[model samples]
Target: MSALPTTATHEPEAPIISAVKSNASAENRVHGLKLAILLGSLTLVTFLSLLDTSIIGTAIPHITSEFHSLPDVGWYVGAYTLGAATLQPLSGKLYAYFPTKAVFMGFVFFFELGSLICGVAQSSTMLIIGRAVAGMGVSGIFNGAITVLSAAVGNEKSPLYFGIVLGTSQMGIVCGPLIGGALTEHASWRWCFYLNLPAGGLAVLILAFIHFPELAQKKTFSMALVRKVVPELDLIGFLLFVPPSVMFLLALQFGSGNTHAWNSATVVGLLVGSGVLAVIFILWERRMGDRAMLPGSLVKQRMVWVSCTYGMCNGCCMMIASNWMPTFFQAVKGEGPTLSGVHILPSILSQLSAVIVSGALISKLGYYLPWALGGGIIMAIGNGLVSTFTATTSVGQWIGYQIVVGAGRGAGLQAPLVAVQNAVKPSQVPIATAFLVFLQNFGVSIGIVLSNVAFTQTLTQAIPLYAPSVSSQAALDAGAGAGAVRDLVRGHEDELSGVLRAYSEGLRNIFYFLVGMSCIAVVLSLGMGWVDVRKKKDSTKSTGDNEAQEKKVEEKSLNEA
Candidate 1:
């Protein structure tokens, strides 16, 4: 609300201060070098974490084949996500207590160790454990990157730096599937996990040498401060929050198809239990005051709630498209993982380009709402176009559809983060940002699970109708087996073509659902109020006041002479 006192004013006697006394003479040469190094290190971490999500998706079939447990494949991805989502809020408190650099380094180490375990894993169980471990590190890495960026640049330059970090991160998401596909096709799927080893190691090295002034140990560890803030960590809130959240996700992912039926006690119980726990967590948070894990004020902020909702919707659409589109390519287009990844390239590239462009524009214009709304609308349109795809759709048409979806995602992804960062106070930035990430993650998990359910159900119903001679039981068996359905259909080209058409139809249905979801996102984006980057306003006013005061000082000196 008010301008933060400039460092020049805070430390008037510092020798370098004189250089910054006037606008033309101002120099941040040393600070600029430090910022570049820190940003570079953080960018790598951001890229790798996002890259893992898509890269692994492209490698899922390979992992399933090696483990010979197709049913358990979801856990490999789910475990990592669950771990990351669970630890996100905690990372905020950890930053408050520990030296940020040390914590960041420690987390990267954990991430590398997890990558090593995953690369060497001989069984699904081992891989799941590895994923869980990697997720813990990932949770810290992403949150840490954002926290460090804000602290290093301060509020005035934060949006620009945040945009850069996010934009760079999108590159990892774009490249991940292609990289994973190439490795899976030519070498081994194991390389997907192994790739992170070198990348993570490089990031660790960069961070070790890069001086982040924000993370420097300012005061000796204070037991009193720790004691004061410990209650705010909301251990009980987490206890209520995590188990139910995980259970709800599990119910969504595993309770469909062969794992459990919608009517079954296992599915019904987990879903109901999760709901009750969520309600309890909210109540507990309300009772805890500042100690609440999610403060009540967070919900009251219209911008925060709207931005979060918009993020959740966009996240849902993005995940659904990313996860299922590859499968569609394999099923309908008869493409391998490598080709499927390549086909999706347009979407990934567009997303990356859009993010960078949006970041620059936001920095220059100092507004985010219009971009947010435009992004949502474009995403809706793109998703709607994708819903029209049929088994016989041309490759060019497919590529076009992908490009549209990518553009929409790219435009929208960074807006919510900008909105939240702009709306909250500096101290609340980490928690607020974490909350946005949490909702996005939760939305992604939900989207994948929901889309999978819809796809499975549609395939089940259509397979029998489209290929009557195949028999319902046989179709079910084929659907359950890894690659067996494709192999079977490959042998009976004519009949299988019909079944593939049905699968494509089912996919189109799921895309339609995504389109509707994205439309809702667009509506939510429209509700994000107006862009109001707090520091920008204060900086402009302060600059004007300073200029006017300087003129008065110069006039008085002249009159005295």
Candidate 2:
């Protein structure tokens, strides 16, 4: 009656969190103080990297003031996403094939470099470039954090650890707006980026003292090794992947409703070129087979597809809302950047709480599907409710809507990763993790561009009806920041209210799209299948039998001695 295969994917092994690894003895494990520092540093790295993504959200108004470009909002906001998405597969493979600690530290160097660049950047384009570099490092760090954490605490307990780490680091991401706002208002917008340098530097310093799982089996990076490493990293495959990806995302950024007409040469040409490149990539990957950056066999798995889709949908809903919510507070509510960031805290805190609780529930119950399924339904309701928000929306209504939306997003954020990790072999886990991360970034990138498209398209029509004296372009320009909006309608109260309502309508359309994506996520989540993580590897060892395990370990250690 069920499609579940009993013997293939689910290989039996004794649960090993409290037991010796099947590969190495108990002595190889790092515990106590050193372990705490390792995990804390890893979480810190993650926090700083993710903080960059949102820290700029509230600071954007300040940023736009200096740059004077509003249409490039997607460029500034998603530049890091572009880098994160592009480097994902390679980042995963690097962790898989190289020494983990060394590669992680290397990524930290590059991430810090990007932060330094952003702090000193003079133009919007330069800032976007810096963000892209930082994003590249974030990609490796994300994959490495998961891989390294799993090795530290066996796969059996990884879900809980991941929850702890993600829950902790996510604080940086959601709170970035608050921190960025304060810094932007009091100090300078550059402080938002400058903040990462010292914090990330300290995290790297702590990491240098620790040992990693991959280091125990280190290989010299000789010329012969380079020959193997090049192919292993799938340099050619990524070369093909990068161009088409950039083309596709750029097309979305300039999509008809946002910048150019559907029939315009620029949009049409980019779409066609991107499609052709994508086809070539698929064909080349097919030829490369297992050696490809995206292996066909792994990519073809039902669970893998479902997980990637689910991750994409979850990211799409969450990221688009995050980007727009701050704008709502500033534009319609006429709040300062600091107050806007404060108002957005409900969503952030609720999302974090949901992730921590949901992760614990999944670990205890050994089921991720129910959370994924339920989260979608709740998220759909949340997004739909949020879509109803308007200029006159009350404080209670906004906060309540955000909490609901955040709960739904946080509940399902990592379900796909948990599901994929369970479905694949340990060796293939890095690849799967990379794939999931890629799709999540991809979804986020496209969602952000499209949200802008939806917002801009609605504003174009609404501005004419709402404020007859104001040109559509001028009103659109006014939305570059709240200051601009106030300046544009300073003389007329009626025009001000009209512009505010236009903003509400424009943001509403974005939520409508999110509602549809949430429903699709619900459908995709259903196909992740059902597997009890505990039963899959429950064998001779069980944490429930702790006394027996201690005695067995003691005897084994004595025998070796």
TM-score on alpha carbons, each prediction:
0.83, 0.87
56-140 per-residue lDDT for model 2 (tens digits): 8887766765675555566665778877887887886576456788788888888899898989999878998898888888878
Top candidate by lDDT: 2
Pairs with steric clashes in candidate 2: none
* Per-model lDDT: 0.74, 0.80
The best candidate by TM-score is 2
* Predicted structure 2: lDDT: 0.80
Candidate 1: stretches off by over 4 Å: 1-40, 64-78, 122-126, 146-166, 205-212, 215-229, 363-366, 468-485, 532-540, 543-561
What TM-score does structure 1 among the candidates reach? Answer: 0.83
Report the lDDT tens digits of candidate 1 across residue range 361-388.
8877878888888988899889888888
